[model samples]
Target: MSLFDKFEPLNAQYVRLEAIDANPFAITFDHVLSPTEAMIGDSRILLLGTNNYLGLTYDTEIVTKAVQATRAFGTGTTGSRIANGSYDGHKKLERALKDFYGRKHAMVFSTGYQANLGIISTLAGKNDHLLLDADSHASIYDGSRLGHAQVTRFRHNDPNDLHKRLRRLADVPGDKIVVVEGIYSMLGDTAPLREFAEVKREWGAYLIVDEAHSLGVLGETGRGLAEMQNVEPDVDFVVGTFSKSLGSVGGFCVSNLDDFDILRVACRPYMFTASLPPGVIAATMEALHQLRARPELRLRLIENARRLYAGLTGLGFCLGPEPSPVVSAIMPNPETAFALWSDLLKAGLYTNVSLPPATPNGLALLRSSVSAAHTPQQIDHAIALFEQTGRALGMVPASAATHASHHAAASPSLSVTSA
Candidate 1:
């Protein structure tokens, strides 16, 4: 057989998507205008699929810091941190993260995926057990497989199921590490962290929470769900990314464990990969400072999310369980979801088309995330476009359109003073 024959099934699926003009996987942005808008080819489209929750991608301060760092440290590290990639800026960023999370130690990785891979694989080794949420991110699953531990998955957000699984392992002589996310990326639903923490405590298992989507979008101080749910003490490790709220590229793990520093040498992913560029580290630090100094950004983000959620629900689109920065609409099927996504793109709106394996429970999703930089008019315009597209696609009725328009008209002002 040919070397590429194994990808025949994937090729067939790609052709099917292209035939329907719904091949979102091949789409690309030519230029980014702002945090909430971008140019795809020659058309300017409103960006709704980005995870830039606080919308600091184009912030003046962040850009300035990045530029300064580039001039100071040259371009790339050109080597792994274990060799020559560890610089003053990298060490400084780790220290800042350690202070930010109030943890005893912090280790930064080149990418968010590596942070998960390095931490999870190193923590649960040969004789250990890893209990993961069924809806956990792909990185978590890959990390579990990289290690020699036996992995068990509990139902998504089901604390009772987690308890039962941990109980079954009561007789097993090994360390148990329970992994969960602060906010699920697909459905925008948050995990019952308080309950999960309780269960982990009762079962004597260490808890690791991935706050990739919740950081800068939850908690009074923007710590994460653990802080929002008041269970920080129950959590043993916190894994997060600078790519999301921080508007940069990197990942980190913070823990109060006394020997957490050992991971610097033990984690293969971290030791083998080159570190982040100096510019990225600088920009991420600045963004973190901005996130802490400006709490109103989080408020504005939630307000925008609530507005969009209300508008879409009023137009009869099935949405996630609640209003969050990450909002997704479930479609009847993959074809319908693809058609809707293509329609939205044609209407100058850009969103994510998530299909099975990537989405939860085989559900197709038209995912749109709200950014703090999204203006009120931009959000309202997006709602109007969704209504028009939904009606044209028979996803929403004409009667629902009237109600949606009325709801949008009667909506309160979205003005919130920045700090």
Candidate 2:
């Protein structure tokens, strides 16, 4: 048997998607005009699926810093951080992260995925225990497998289930590390951090919160769910990414543990991977400054999310339980989800099409992440497009489409019937 045989199923799926020109995975924007808009083969597309929550990708200050750094430090850092890759920008960014989180130590990685991989895998040793949410990100699961720790998954967002699992390990001797995300990527649902924190404390387990999606989107100071829930003090580690609200590429872990710096030497993912370039580091630092300086961005982001969530809900689309930056509409099946995503793209509204395996509970999703940069008119236009497409596909009701059309009337520049 060939090693490629295992990919036959995926190849079949791609073939089916390509037959109708509905391959969501192959989409490439010809030009990104702004955080809320882009061009795909000359078609003006409203970007609804990007995780640019604060929408600072085009900020002049951030961009300027990035350009300046690139000019000063060249294109790339060719070596790993443990070797010759560590630069001043790297250290400054780590210090900025530590200061922002009020933590004692901060470790940066080349990518957000590596941040979880480095931290989770390194901390949980052969004899340790790794207890994570059942729907934890792939990075977390990979990290669990990378280490010798015995991995156990509790129910997603169910603190009671976590407690039960931890109790069974109570008699065990290994250290327990409980990992959870601030905001689940699929459904946009938030973890009850406070409840999980209580469980961690009750069981004397260390808690790690991956705020990859929630950073600069939650908390008064944009510290994430832990800060919003007033459970920051109880959390043992906070891991996040600069690619989201920060609008760059990198990952970090911040903690108050006195010996947290030791991970720099022990984490294989951190030690072996090349450090982020000067531009990314500079832009991320500037973005952090902007995130703290502009709390209004956070307010506008939540307001926009609520608008989209309400609009979709009014159209009879099932959505996440609460309103957050990430808003997703549940689909009945893969075919329907694929159709909706393709139709949405053709209608100049781009969204994410999430299928089983990556998504929780084997469900399909038409995911849309709102940005503060999106104007109310743009939001209305997006809703109008969804209504038109959903109605055409017979997924949304005719009456609901008629009712939703009134909201689109004010968006004079955008046409609801683009298709």
Candidate 3:
């Protein structure tokens, strides 16, 4: 059989997507105008797809820090920290993370995915067991495969199911680690962390909360869902990426566990991957400072999210359970979802289209992440656009268009801040 045979189904899907000029995966932004807007082809569109939760990507201070660091340390670190040598900035960033999380130790990885790969694979030894939420991110599942641990998946966000799964392995001779996310990316629903923590404690299992989407978007000071749920102590490790709220590149793992530094030598992904550029580290450090200092950003983000979520709901569309920065509208099917996505793009609105295996239960999603940078006017405009597109495509009732009319009319003209 040909090596390419396995991808025939995927190729067929791509062909279908191409037929309607709705290849969401192939979108290219010609120019990014700001955290809230970008140019696609010749048309400028509201940027609802990018996960810039706090919208610090275009902050002058962060950008200045990055530029200064690039000038001082050169463009990139040519080798891995283990091989070449650790930069002072790397250590400083790790220390900042430890202080931010109030943890005893922290380790930085070249990428967020690597952080999961290194930590999960390294911590779960051959004799260990990993109990993961069934809807855990692909990185978590991939990490399990890279290690020798016996893996089990419980029902998504169901603590009782997790408890039952752990009970089944009560007698299993190995360390137990429960892995989950603070905020799931697709649907934007948060895990019941307090309940999960209780389950973990009852079973004497370690807990890892991946806050990739929740960082800088949740909690009183943005320590993520563990802090918001008041279960920080129960979470043995907090893994996150700077790519999201921080608007930089890299991943980090913070923990109170003893001898955590040993992972520097134990994790092959950590050892093999090149270290992040000095500029990225500096930019991320500045972003972290901003995230902690500016709680208003979080407030604005949630407010924007509520507006969009409510607006979409008013338009007679099914959406995620709660109002979150990642506002996802459930589509009836992939075809309708693809058509809506294309129409939205053509109408100067850009949103993420999640389909098939990437989405939970093979569902189709028109996902849009609200940003602190988005003005109320922009949010209302997006709603109006969705109303128009949905109605035109029969995805929403014709009468649904009236729901957004008042808000759209009251919304002032769109004005995007220059990045």
- By summed lDDT, the worst window of 10 consecutive residues in model 2 runs over 410-419
Instruction: Give me the displacement of residue 377 in model 2, in angstroms.
Output: 0.5
Q: How close is candidate 2 to the true structure, as a TM-score?
A: 0.95
Question: What's the number of clashes in each of the models?
Answer: 0, 0, 0
Model 2 spans with C-alpha error above 4 angstroms? 401-419
**Residue 206 accuracy (lDDT) in model 2:** 98
Every candidate's lDDT: 0.89, 0.89, 0.89
Q: For candidate 1, which ten residues in a row score worst on lDDT? A: 410-419
- Backbone clash total for model 3 is 0
> What TM-score, computed on C-alpha atoms, does each candidate reach?
0.96, 0.95, 0.95
Specify the poorest-scoring 10-residue window by lDDT in model 3.
Answer: 410-419
Candidate 2 per-residue lDDT over residues 76-121, each given as its tens digit? 8988989885899999998999999999999999999999999999
Candidate 1 regions exceeding 4 Å error are 401-419
lDDT of 1 at 391: 92
